[model samples]
Target: MKKVLLLTCVLCLAASLAGAADTIKIGVMAPLTGAWASEGQEMKQIVDLLGEELNAKGGLLGQQVEIISEDDGGDPKTAALAAQRLSTQEVIASIGTYGSAITEASQNIYDEAGILQVATGSTAVRLSEKGLQYFFRTSPRDDDQGKVIARTIMEKGVKKVAVLHDNSTYSKGLADEAKAILEEQGIEIVFYDALTPGENDYTAILTKLKAAAPEIVLATTYYPETGLLLRQKKEMGWDVQLVGGDANSNPDLIKIAGADAAAGYLMICPPVPKDLPSEEAQNFLAAFEKKYGGTPGSIWAVLAGDAFLVIAEAIKATESTDPEELADYLHTSLKDFPGLTGLLSFNEKGDRVGDVYRVYTVDDQGNFKLLQ
Candidate 1:
């Protein structure tokens, strides 16, 4: 009787272990509770929705898909801790992180642990230049956006411009990129400076920028600061055109600045899902609306969905969760995978291939209208 009992116990333990291994774990690192919480929360929602749909279709490799999310809090130090936690959980891949610095903090951890990482919104060019084999992004780089901004300014016949940044890695990189291109194109840069972000008032900065008397101000900062700058500028009765970078592509900008103040503001970014012409994107928008009650407020979150799609496709094609195999497939084999953003492919440097930036203007009612 004792021998039979021991044998049954061993069999049950084996079965339990097998059942536990019957799922694939994916990690999500995002700023779930900080200044960028809205973007992060939407990232989680999109990923979760996609995971559910995938499982409904029989899951990946015949196993249920599991998502392990870690909050980066939009800070570098917090992101490092999140990355460390995710690395220990045996996740085959991780997607995430809006801020460039926050993503950078977690890059080494994932790379060292042999986990594939796809950054959704960190557009700093140097993130891919580091030669980390596991690092990739679904978003375009800063240099491409800089050229677009410069071209738009030249098209507008704006000779004098003020370039401003928030001193963050991504913001400063974009500001410098656009500034260099403008100078090369013979556009006069009347003022160039970095402003402190997260402040409710930017009147001092506005006064200084107005004194410079530029026809347009290219503000390379997030939506929060951009909204304040626009409102404050309008309050000061300055009518200078404020051209924002991709970071300002959130609806909250209009709310913060108010429609009257936000009217006529221009920005350059990848088209949101509604603007994407792909049938897959349209389907995604419909499903997202039906499930979540509305479309995503920012393109960054959609990029997170793209990151998930890319990882899922790589897994499906390779049929293996080994990071090396997945990374190799993405770097070499994956090409023109239809994503919510566009036909997605990664170059040798791990940056998304193609220039998809479009110019948009805010109307009086705060709607973002594509200009060109």
Candidate 2:
């Protein structure tokens, strides 16, 4: 009787191990706590919701899909560690580490492990330029956004501009690109500087910017710092047009800077899908609002959903989760994927192909209006 009982225990344990082996694991890396935690939380929520939907429809390749999420704290070193840990856990692919600097810092680890990484938010052009075989982004690159911003500024008859960044990989890359495009268009850059993120005050920087008297101020930083800078600019009574990168498009900017201060500030970003021409996009917007209890607080939510869809589609098409095969399908076959954000496709360099950017300005009510 004792021997028979022991055999039953062994069989149950073996079955448990086999079931675990049959589950498809995907890694989710994001800043669950830190300056970017709000955005990261939204991304995580979208991924979790999508995972549930996929499982409800009979998961991928006859296996249950599981998302193993890790918090990177929006730090590069932490991102690398998270990537290393996820690689060891048999994740077929990983998504995120939102900031470009963190993603760049962690790419080598995923590359060495041959794990596909779909970047949901990182937009530094160098991310794709690094020839990383396993790295791809659902977001548009900074250069594309820069061009749109430059053209918008030129159209506004702004001849003198100031460029500022938070010295982050994403901010600096977009700032530099915009500066170059502005210069090429014969616009004088009166001031170009980098600010340390998380600083309590930027009065001194605003004083210097006042001296330059730029007609337009272009900031390529995340919301917290961008809000601070804009508020300071207003308090200092520096009259200038303000514009920023995609990161600055979040509603939190108005919340931080106050509706009055954020009013009339423009941002170059991917078009929000709420009223887009795509019927699928409209459905996604409605479903997301219904499930999440609000409109998405940031674009990261949309990109996160798109990243999940892209990965699931590849898995379904290839009928395998092997990283190499998945990467091959993404590069060669994933075209015109009707993502919530847009029609998605990857170029040879792993950047989204033919992305469209729009210029938006904050209205007095803290709502975004597409620039006519």
Candidate 3:
């Protein structure tokens, strides 16, 4: 009798484990431990919150959602390995590996495996131009952002402009687009060059820019380099309007550049939607602040949230976790997902369908304020 009871318990345990294994796993590949670690961590948090919310609402397709997060270290090789690992784990869909270079490097692995990839922040237009059916982006491409930035600069009455980029795929792409647009608008691009991102000093580049006497200096760089450039430019007394791409919209820029130097620094990025266009946006902001203990550190957080929401909704609508089926649903059925950032929908190329970029500037209080 004792042996029969023990056998029964063992069988029940195996069944429980099998049930647990039937969860819907969503993989997150991001820079969780390198230069872009902060943003990666933010992405992880957003995914976690999404999983929690989905589980609370009786889960997706009657199965609990599980997030499998991997650190890509913001490097191409690392991103490729991460992608392979996630694909091997059989995650239904994956998000991130933020920078465009890393995203490009890892995309082939995901594409070959038929895994769906939803990019949260990689904005290089080439990603969409590749005609990959399995890939999609929740963020606007650099071409869209570049037009907005160039038009904003021209509208601000800035004629002579200098363009600088960090040479990363994201930064250089935006710089090139902006350069073309500015030139087409008859705006003189006095100085244009790319800088290595981690260089300690940019005084030499700043000196050249100072000599160029551009009324506006547009830098396409990440936060760390942007902070250093802004500080050095201020110390050099270069009296030009300093503007940058979405990467500079982080609070760390102000922390690194100091309040005085960071003030009036403009960035073109997806608006944070202070007015809360939808109840979902309002609830997300409140819940994010309550759970995370502060406002989102960057717009990447908002994009990450939207990416997860879109993927989750697609899974629920399709009622299947099959990667190919989910990708088809995402491409065809997912439309106008009222995301925290804005209305979210993908075009035929898997790029977000609408323009969401807005001009933001650091106020004297060292906070980002939308410029109407």
Candidate 4:
């Protein structure tokens, strides 16, 4: 009995020590002060909520976790600077760089330092091909999104389509990929025009498109420009069906367009929030609303939460601050770490796999539901 008591005491001590973690640093790089600011703020909020939730439960490895945030301001130069700064801060993992442009710029910094970067929303296709050993993404990139968009449009039997893009890397790439799919399905390109984003006047563009009279107008651009073009097109009485990529999926786009929004404007994006995975997602949505007093702008947590969870798990697994060791553990261990988005696994190049998305529609009543 005495031996049993001593052994039990030692076991208890080990179990207690096992749950305690030191302060593990996670870096957050996102556009907190630009057009995409809402997404960044939502991500940061949920990341904080996760910290609170985890610490309240047991804390990570006995020590509490802290996330250090950096604002990329939606610029590549600033993003690189932010990543470099975060790297210097010695954070064990990174959770953002919310756009392809930013991710493309900042990934090099993390790669060189052997730091793990889990981009939440940087969906540009080339991101996966950089051979960055420590780079991985929690979100699906544009190519996956593009295929879904094209497939949906083709299923609808819309043959005549007009393509309008911002000519930026994210917009142009997805636009071209989407167009290729449409072509394969025998859809005719009525008008393919690349517009300079943030321009005040698209009157000529709208007028030209109205004359072409295409059955569908596909926009692959950010909200500001999308909203402007949509509002102008309505004012000019161009009544073509407007479909957009994920970039135009912002709920605020309708508010920005006001009464000028077309009656049946369909925006192709990932699955809507309520349609996401299990009760964990719903709980996060509820808690986020309870704390922040608003709905999340997009499915920001789908990206951000996965990034945070992956990093925390890696830190707990390796129990080391060395980025390379953490990355190695993640590459091996992430095979079973189910994400709200999907099952997350990575190839050697650190590219994500097994993410599936659905189309969402923005109707006149502001109801965003999965496209049936």
TM-score of each: 0.96, 0.95, 0.93, 0.89
Candidate 1 ranges with C-alpha deviation above 4 Å: 1-17
In angstroms, how far off is 360's CA in candidate 2?
0.3
Q: Which candidate has the highest lDDT of all?
A: 1
Judge candidate 1 at residue 246 and give its lDDT. Answer: 90
Of the two candidates 1 and 2, the one with more favorable TM-score, higher being better, is 1
Better of 1 and 3 by lDDT: 1
lDDT tens readout by residue for model 1, 1-372? 999999999999999778769989999999899888989999999999999999999999999999999999999999999999999987999999898989999999999999999999999988998899999999899999999988988888988999999999999999999999999989899999999988888999888998999998999999999999989888989998999889988898998999999999999999965688888888888999999899999999999999999999999999999999999999999999999988999988788998889999999889999987
What's model 1's lDDT at 190?
97
Cα lDDT tens digits, model 4, 111-204, are 8877789988777888888777888887777878788878877877887998988877788888998998899889999999888866788888
What Cα-based lDDT does every candidate model obtain?
0.92, 0.86, 0.86, 0.78
Residues 1-372, model 3: lDDT tens digits: 999999999999999879767798889999998878888998999889978988998888778888999999989999999999998887878898688998998888989988889998899989999989889989899999999989889888977999999788899999999999999989999999988888889999999888988998999998899999988888988757788988876788888888888989999998753544778887877887899897677778678888898888887787777777877887877788888887888877888898888888988898889885
Give one digit per residue, the lDDT tens place, for model 2 in 134-226.
Answer: 888998889998888888889889889988898888999999998998899899999999888999899998888879989889989898998
Best by TM-score: 1
Q: For model 3, what is the C-alpha lDDT against the true structure? A: 0.86
- Model 1 / residue 133 / CA error / Å: 0.2
TM-score of 3: 0.93
